[model samples]
Target chain A: MSRRLAAALRPAAAIGCALAAMAIALALLGASPLAVAADLADGAFGNWIAFTDTLARATPLVFCGLAVAVAFHGALWNIGADGQLVVGALAAGALGPALAGAPHTLAIVAIIGAGGLAGALWGGLAGWLRARRNVNEVISTIMLNFIAAQLLSWAVHGPLMEPSGAFPASRKIAAAARLHLYFAPTRLNLAMLFAVALAAVCELGLFRTVPGFELRALGRNRRASAFFGLPIARLTVGAMALSGALAGCGGAVQISAITHRLYETISPGWGYEAIAVALVARLSPLGVVPAALLFGALDNGSQAMQRADGVPAQLVYVVQALVIIVMLAFDAAAGGGWRELLEGGAPDRPDATAETCDA
Target chain B: MLEAFAASTIAMATPLLLAALGELIVERAGVINIGIEGAMLAGAFAGVAVAHATGATLAGVAAAIGGGVAINAIFAFVAVNLAVNQVVAGTAIDLLAAGVTGMLYQRIYGATGRAFTVAPMRPIALGPLARLPLIGRALFDQSALVYLAFALVPAIAWTIGRSRFGLSLRAAGERPEAADALGLGVYRLRWIALLASGALSGLGGAYLTLAYADTFVEGISAGRGYVALAVVIVGRWNAWGVAAASLMFGAAIALQFVLQAAATAIPYQLFLALPYLLTVAVLALMGGQADAPSALGEPYIRA
Candidate 1:
């Protein structure tokens, strides 16, 4: 097979292996894998409403997937995309009620823009820490995710609670700020189109821009990038900010298009799920869409599968985890970029206590 | 209030201390398992399920250890044998554990999401110490797991800081190629460290359901695993430091409970967010990876 075909086939094979593993698991749990699979498919793509819902669900994944791809491409281990998205939604939700009388277009822009900015700051905080303080991004991001979740919980239950104070949710956004559904009675909206456009823009920016080149170079060889006069600190913060903006915008879109109000659980672990999406796409900006859709279909279909086959909807998370594991194993076995993919540049930081040379 | 706070602090610190101690060993052996949270979750679920089924807390604890080890075994195969990126593989492990545990919990307990509780392990009070003043109940009156966790601190400190085996583990982490060249068996050391870490993490998970909480909830590990990761760093990768860091975090968590009960003017969410915020702030202050294992998080394959 041509290298391109082989490359394309690899992820498919990995996904296949993951499904096979899930099949065994399902069978052990006394559920027929085939029936479960059929139910999932019937639920996800069996009808127009289902298909539209899948796309809508995939929207956030697309945004967060891009966020993961951007940051991972720079070798910044950002495990806080979910946190960023939450902060973004919080910002948008907070700003949404105040935009009641504003022009429709302006209100929409303000909501999304606010979310993106909040997300940027949130992500950028970890980035700055990594750049200046030498704090590990992985740990910092995870901590930030917890903090973000608490912040949202506080918002919904306290300041942002609906006026009736009956439910732990924020007030609905103004009609002007809402991204109206394009198809009546369907969840399809302009957010999906915007996401697609952003993906294209991200692909272009990542490949065709000088800054993008610098980021990838930094990811590939951090020491070399530093030695070559690449502004390591600047690139780190910028990539993280951009990544956060993408995820934040995703959150804003969800608020504008779907939920229209804030709640404790704004995201369903989209940030972590995006890791699988980005990895399956091999951190490709353009590939995130399809990858997100695949996972989204599983997510959208899971509830139906649960009802039909006595399976839990969380089974999709198992599929996601398996896909990632299988993909990583396949890639490692195939002699792919395991080192650079994770450790970024040098595997070891210079330890003043002992080791002189690092692997 | 002081005595209650002190006891809560010790109770809260136990799980973090247990997990952090395990991670310290894993990091010392040159592999960082981000999946510690996943292992703990699996342990928590398995402990509750088995104990509920068999009416034996010991059986629950055993099952919890096995659950954690089982999760880590997959991680070991992928991270150690396959030489995959440890962080991503660990993340996958976390997700898998969450998915598996959540699914099984739902399947067995029904989809209504009712609370499930088991008989909690009884506390064993030390003879004279239990009857003493402020620190007595906090220090001497606790479940076997609490005492074991604190006891492991010095034991782990001595084992890693002084033992010949610790030397080999450090060698593997510092420079795997060099360690391999010296016949230290880097892969073997890493595998052993990961499995040991898994068991400790599992035990920590069991402590949650069997001793402290007496109930199992999905994601009950609740970022405690991550906090333990931070504890290793803040503890400066030593057992004593880990113990200290865990106590500080435990105090923060305990304080939250106390403050929440008082129903103060302050928002409860602030209290809930305290420990996580502390993790970030402490990590920022700790700054730099100067004390970290040289080959930590690096994939090492045998030649």
Candidate 2:
């Protein structure tokens, strides 16, 4: 088989394995696996509304997945995307009211810009620590995620709390600041459009731009990159910041378009799941699109599975975990297609020796 | 006030110390086991389920150890044998634990009202030590796990730093190829380290449900496992350092309780962030990458 076809088949085979495992699990629960599968399919793609909602749900994942994918290409672990996302949501929510008096375009732009900047700062902090201080990004990012959670709760409950004091959430943004709802009843909005556009941008930035080449070069061999005069520290920080900006964009889109206001819980661990999404996509920016949608469908379908089949909604988390494991197995079995995928299949792969384990 | 804080700090530190010490061993054996969290969660679930079912805390703790071992065995298979991405595999283990535990809790307990609550393990007071002043009483009077956790520090420190096995374990992590060339059986050494760490991590988890909280809450392990990860870093991967760092984090938790009770103006979330903030702050101060094991996250293959 062609390497590309084998690469594509790897994920498909992994998905099949994951489904079989879930089927066995369902049997243990005394539920019909076939019925659960049918219900899940129905919930995710049964009708136009379900499909649209699935796409709507996929929007945030697309952005976050791309964020993770881009960072992973440079051999960076940006687990703080979740924290960055929350800060994005918080920034947009806090700024929404202040921008009500401005023109619609300016108000929207400012909210998005503020959100992106907040995310960038958060991501940049970890990147800076990794670059300058030699701190491990994984641990720092995880700690930052905890701090971000507290910050979100503090804001929701203390500062930007609703006027009525009945709920732990900020007041809904001014109607004008909210993104236009497209294909009503499905929560589809302009944010999905932006996510798609950004995915394209990420593709160009990673493969076409000079900075992208340097970043990829750094990822391939830091020793060589440094010897060749690449600014290793600066590129690391920039890639991380840009990665955070994308995730922050996700948080902004989610709050502005779907939630319409910041709440105590804005995401159901999309940032964590985005790791699986990006990894499964082999760190391909374009590949992240379908992978995100697959996750969205799993999430959307889990709700249906719960409603129609008496299964616990937490089943989706199980499937997600299984997917990551299965994908890793497949990638390993393929003798490191993961590295090739991340390096975007260049003719001269500089990172042939790079192991997927670090990621 | 100081005495009360000191006593609570010991309580909070036991679990963190156990997990960190366990992670220390795992990292020393060439595997950065992120799945320590998952193993701890499994132990937590097993401890609560068995204790609640059989009405024996000791039995529950044993089962928890077994559960932790089982989870780590899977980790060994993937990380040591298949040589998959350790972070992704570890994360998958965590998610699997969360989902399985949550679903089982819901199915068995029915997602409503108070779930089954086991009797919290009573602290055992050492004869004369219990009668002593503030420091003595707090230190000597504690659950068996607390004592085990503290005692393990020297035991672990010696086993890792002085023993022949210790040299081999470090050799495996530092340079697996060299270790293998010397006929040390790198995979075998790593598996042993993983199993040992799993048992310790499990003991920590059981301490939470059977001794600390005395009940199971969904995701009750919470961020403690991850906090233990930070503690490993803050501890500089040393046993005594782990104890000190864990105590510091324990103090952070105790301070949160004291602060929350002292005022209504300050949001409780600020205190919640204390340990995490401390972790980041410590990492910032430490400078970086000088202390990490060379082959810490690599999956060793007999290349």
Q: Clashing residue pairs in candidate 1, if any? A: none
lDDT of 1 by residue, A32-101 (tens): 9999999999889989999999999999999999999999888788889999999999999999999999
Any residue pairs clashing in model 2, and if so which? none
What's the TM-score of each model vs. the native? Answer: 0.97, 0.95
Error of 2 at B259 (Å): 1.8
Q: Which stretches of candidate 2 lie above 4 Å from their native place?
A: A340-359
- Once all C-alphas are superposed, what RMSD does model 1 give against the true structure? 2.1
Among all windows of ten consecutive residues in candidate 1 chain B, which has the lowest summed lDDT? B107-116
TM-score of chain B of each: 0.98, 0.97
| Cα lDDT over the full model 2 | 0.84
Best by lDDT: 1
Give DockQ for candidates 1 onward, in order: 0.73, 0.51
Grade the docking of candidate 2: medium
Instruction: Give a tens-digit lDDT track for model 2, residues A1-359.
Output: 99889988888888789889999999999999999999999999999889888988899899889888888777776777889899989999998877767887777788888889988999999889887777777778878888988999999998899899899999888776788887677687778788888988998998999999898877666656766767878998999899888888888888878888999889788888898898778787988899999999999988898889878888888888888888887777778555433322111112212233233
Task: Report the error of model 1 at residue B51, Å.
Answer: 1.2
Model 2: DockQ score? 0.51
